[model samples]
Target: MSYVITQTCCNDASCVAVCPVNCIHPSPDEPEFATAEMLHIDPKTCIDCGACADACPVEAILPDDKLDPSQMRFAEINAAWYEDHPAPEGWKPLVPTPAPPRDRGTLRVAIVGAGPAACYAAQELLERSEVEVEMFDRLPTPFGLVRAGVAPDHPGTKAVTESFEWSFRREEFALHLATEVGRDITHAELLEHHHAVIYATGASSDRRLGVAGEDLPGSHAATEFVAWYNGHPDYADRTFDLSGERAVIVGNGNVALDVARILTMDVDELARTDIADHALTALRKSNIREVVLLGRRGPAQAAYSNPEFLALGDLTGVDVVVDDADLELDPVSARAVEEDAATALRVRLASEYAGRPVRPGHRRIVFRYLAAPSELLGDDHVTGVR
Candidate 1:
């Protein structure tokens, strides 16, 4: 039997690199990847070799026979993707990258920030016969976003860090943690010690929406909220005002959905994961019963990935609220939805949620489309949103 990709797929595409038959659709190089909800495996071409399953960080792939009742539907989902995408037309000859000249001799490299890119770069460099690597990070911890940015409940996604262990174990590799580069070491010093320096420091700040009251005390960026909940040292002391019954997030992207989920999730379930004590305590005391995500575009143009949108519906005691009005797209968008499988799936999923009854007494996440925040309401703290 072939392997099927399930709802938990994180879209990290770790499995794509390991698939021997190249059955995974929307590999990072493909145009579909940017809009793809989740990567799909082509069952017709799958060898059932289990290599993709082994490499999948979130354990999203399972053989058809091994799938439980809840996941059995994914078998058809996998097959359906191939109906539209089909098998890759033909195999291309493998082109090997040329090795550095022998005279280059015992290559030494310095990598700044121990994030996924740095670790992966170290791995690739260490694979060369004479290469040696030294990795440095300002923070004491490693795996930048994997440790501090990923939602704690999604531990399976964090397991991708295991692949980086080899870089630490290599005799030619060195790691320097809790050492700031500008203060502890200079760019000239890095150049003096290594052949090249690669900076992998991930984005640390959030993009502002530039509304008038955005600078008010109650308003906060999605990145800050994520870091606060994930226990990043920089934000462990941070706090949020949870006394309000309804919270409004300005965007419809993954982070906005994540913020909504974290706000509405059962505190007990959150406790089982590694959420920060401070944030969890606040959640337990939260009076927030509704989280409204505002999007400037229609449902077809919503920014969330399909897997995340699907997971939101599965949360216990939470209702994904969608208005029927948002699902009706204009003629141009309607045509795009019909032609693009990814966009069509997003609209179909939103329509399903729109048709579902909002259970009484369940906490709600309302999807508000074709709406943008003109200004945050209130003089001191947020009292309402316009």
Candidate 2:
């Protein structure tokens, strides 16, 4: 009977402003709004006005009858939030007051990097009639990570980029290709032509393991591994030493999951997506059968999202294992993990793994936590990591 906010929500919180009953918790005024993984609609107090659904620009809100098959889990997820915490009676939805029109002066903006942040900023600016936007990037293509950072198998996530493309095509937007700032042009020069220059250059650098032998031939950062497999032009010609039967990743973040998934996924399944050709050919030649995802904290402290870990289990020909020793939750993290729907999913995945050696010929993803990497042992090349 209640509307559910699904995966497409994106934490934008557009729906909360329009709801009259103010049933949504952690509204932009709440302290948790910034860090909450996604916005949730309180089922207990929802009046079913459908105002929130109408306000969501991404069409992420779903009423009971129209719930998409893949998104049905969200209904249970939304309801679960109020299991222990009861909603107060007579609470009214907070309806947002429309803002006065902005007096956008005749200012020209040039944004560098056409990634998610850049595109979102452009969309916001384009609402005004007096602003003109020009987006620039080094690559000939657009939508940086949407094309390269996302997993080849995640067609739905990649599809989100279409809205950005539509904006550029339909609006009076200008895009300059093969033009990189600081290389082809300098920041000062661009400022001369435009009133404001915004740099949406995302974190391009990867954190190093900082252990000895990190620079060895076989050892690689997850960023490089992801970019290579996704067919990024800069990494298209790069190669990895997947000759070993086992590989170890140093972190347990979403990017680490991406690396493990790409390495373990069947080449045929990847080919069905828009994966880069050169990287696909190299993945087909990989001999790796196991990947150890190392984390410095317990499972409750792990940084990966629940949906990501759950999706890992569904990949073809891959087995995900979680060590029981790492799943123990400290008091604080335990409470937080239990409250989060995504973390709850990860906790369930950890419980499903019993003590057993992973079968051979099948790709294995091992979740190792609360242990620090003392060293990366190797000689001329990475023989075997400790």
Candidate 3:
């Protein structure tokens, strides 16, 4: 049996460079490399060498025999990509990179955020003998998005945070929680102690809707919604008005999908994850039954990856709907699917969703294309969306 790439794969192609057998699809040289969501390994060609698993930054690859029950589905998912063509023989092996000499003197580096990027940076520096790394975060916790942004139901994806724990336990690393660069500490102070400073502070603020009535009680940024559910201290006191039956999200991106999923997910399922207590209570009482995702472009131009789009289909007790009128691609989009593998996959899935009969489900998500929010339609609170 071969290894499988799971949902945590971010399409960085790090595995492709290390694979000796060239079993991974959508290599860096391919046009679809940019458009593809995740790389797949041909089961027949993969020699079960485990090189790809070792090289994956997110720890998304797992040997078929060792897969957790939740991730067993990926074995078939990976094999399906190369079903038509048979595997070839004579695979090359990968040579591991040797650690550099420890002649260099102790070098101190400061990283401003404890997000995925910063943790990876700390991991790389800790690989060297003489490096001392300091990670600082204002929230008093590490693993930024893994702790605060990822949906609670996505336990498999969130498990990637465990890889960072390895770096945190290293003797060469120190974690400074509840510290702010401009508040608790000064830039000059860090420069005096550390040789280099790295800022991995992720997008902390949300992009504003920039329309009238945006400040209404019912309206909110998708970022806050995600943070609130994930138990971010800053948004712990915040609340969303879920009394309304219908909710409209102005974007078709992954974050938008996350918020929609949280709003509509089964309260029992969410209870199994690490979602905040307050958020779980609020979600249980939520009256929302319909979520409309408005995209400025057609279905072919969706901003989310194929995996995210496919997950919507797999969601239980939720009906996924795509208007047939919204799926009619123009000439430019038609050519894009022909040339881009990712676009082709997204369009194909969305097209299939359009044909699916709208069975009665507890909640429904409607994907509407070629529409942009002009203004929020409400008086004191959001009564409706225009």
Q: In terms of TM-score, which candidate is strongest?
A: 1
* lDDT of model 2 at position 218: 85
Report the lDDT tens digits of candidate 3 across residue range 14-52: 798788888887676666567667889998788899998
Cα shift from native, residue 235, model 1 (Å): 0.8
List residue ranges in candidate 1 displaced over 4 A: 8-14, 68-73, 89-94
Model 3: lowest-lDDT 10 consecutive positions: 84-93
lDDT of 1 by residue, 148-205 (tens): 8888888877877888887899999999999988999999999998889998997787
**What's the true lDDT of residue 52 in model 1?**
88
The better candidate by lDDT, 1 or 3, is 1
Model 3 spans with C-alpha error above 4 angstroms: 12-20, 25-35, 49-59, 62-104
Ranking the candidates on lDDT from highest down gives: 1, 3, 2
What is the alpha-carbon lDDT for the whole of candidate 2? 0.77
Measured with C-alpha atoms, the lDDT of residue 204 in candidate 2 is 93
TM-score of 3: 0.88
Model 1 is weakest, by summed lDDT over 10 consecutive residues, at: 89-98
Each model's TM-score, in the order given?
0.94, 0.85, 0.88
